[model samples]
Target: MFRLQFDLDRIIGTLEREGWVVIPNALSATITANLRTACLDMWRQGLFHEAATGRASGQACRAEIRADSVLWLDQVAALPAVQAYNAAMDDIMQAVNRGLYLGLVELESHFAVYPEGAFYKKHLDRFRDDDARTLTTVFYLNEGWPQQAGGQIRLYLDADCREFVDVGPEAGTLVLFLADRFWHEVLPARQQRLSVTGWYRRRRSSMPW
Candidate 1:
């Protein structure tokens, strides 16, 4: 079984203090390479669909607002790499919940492929209609990605959006943040980009029914 090799204490501490944390080498090199290969293979097989904006009835494909293709991981959980990734994320969820008491109980994730020039505008992960999503996590799988790639995730540190940080789409890098509190965007890249993006969710206090 694949295992995550990272300093959990430091990571949890940073997240508790900053509300966001970026960790390098969050996954082993072998697992990162495997995930990258899986993403590209799936893309070549035409398993990805154009990603949409909004939620439920409001969702629609708006290229101007965002441009990326995605393959939901729900149906592919048995894949070896995917299972390993899920296991790692579960560990993270448990740690965060133990440390922060966020009540995160589940994870929803997808493989996102950004073709050249693809981008996503600034937005929060939690939907206006549904607030179950409590935390956002993004693990990049682009091997040997460079600073010049331009496919960095710009994370806004404050509500006013003045303070920010741009994180590169580099392999083995994981970004974690409070889902509803942060505004973020994907900067357009000259080449393709690949990552597994997910949200850790809590049970809703009341159902829509």
Candidate 2:
């Protein structure tokens, strides 16, 4: 198992104070390279589908609002590189639960590819029908992304959506934040942007059908 190198205390502290944190070099170069290769392979194979909005039954592709393509990472056994990445996330999840007592029981992730001019509009991650998603995590895989690249993620700081922070899509960088608290958008990209996006979800009792 790959050992996690992040500072757990600092991550938790930042989450408590700012509702989000951007960690540079969060993943090792080797892992990042492997992930990039895997993503590209999947893309070449036409495994990615246009991303959609809304929850479970109501989800539908709305290309006008968001144009990225995504392949859901449901089976870790499909790729050794992805499996290692998932293991590392498991460790982080355990640490987060221990520190914040968020009771995050599971994580779901997808490999996302945003082609030139693709973007997602301002929105929160959690859906109104389900409140399971507690935290959102986005790990970028684009190496040496230039400042001129227009695909930075813009995160609004408050309810009024006035002040914000724009994060570049840098390789090995990870962005974490409360799912329901932040309003964020992806700006149009000058080049292709790649990332593994995930969410930590709290367990909820299922209603009898």
Question: In the order shown, what is each candidate's alpha-carbon RMSD?
Answer: 1.7, 2.1
Which lDDT tens digits does candidate 1 get at residues 1-209? Answer: 14677888888899889989999999888878888888898899999999999988899999998999999998777788888888889988888888889999999999999999999999999887788999999999998998898999999999899999999999999999999899999999889999999999999766464
- Per-residue error for 107 in candidate 2, Å, reads 0.7
Which residue segments of model 1 deviate by more than 4 Å? 207-209
* Tens digits of lDDT, candidate 2, 1-209: 25566788899888988889999988788888999999999999998999999877888999999999999988434798898888888888998898889999988999999999999999999877677899999999999999998899999999999999999999999999999899999999999999999999997646343
In candidate 1, which residue pairs get closer than 3 Å at backbone N, Cα or C atoms, i.e. clash?
Answer: none
TM-score of each: 0.96, 0.95
Question: Pairing residues by index, what is the TM-score of model 2?
Answer: 0.95
lDDT of 1: 0.91
What is each predicted model's overall lDDT from 0 to 1? 0.91, 0.91
RMSD of 2: 2.1
Best by TM-score: 1
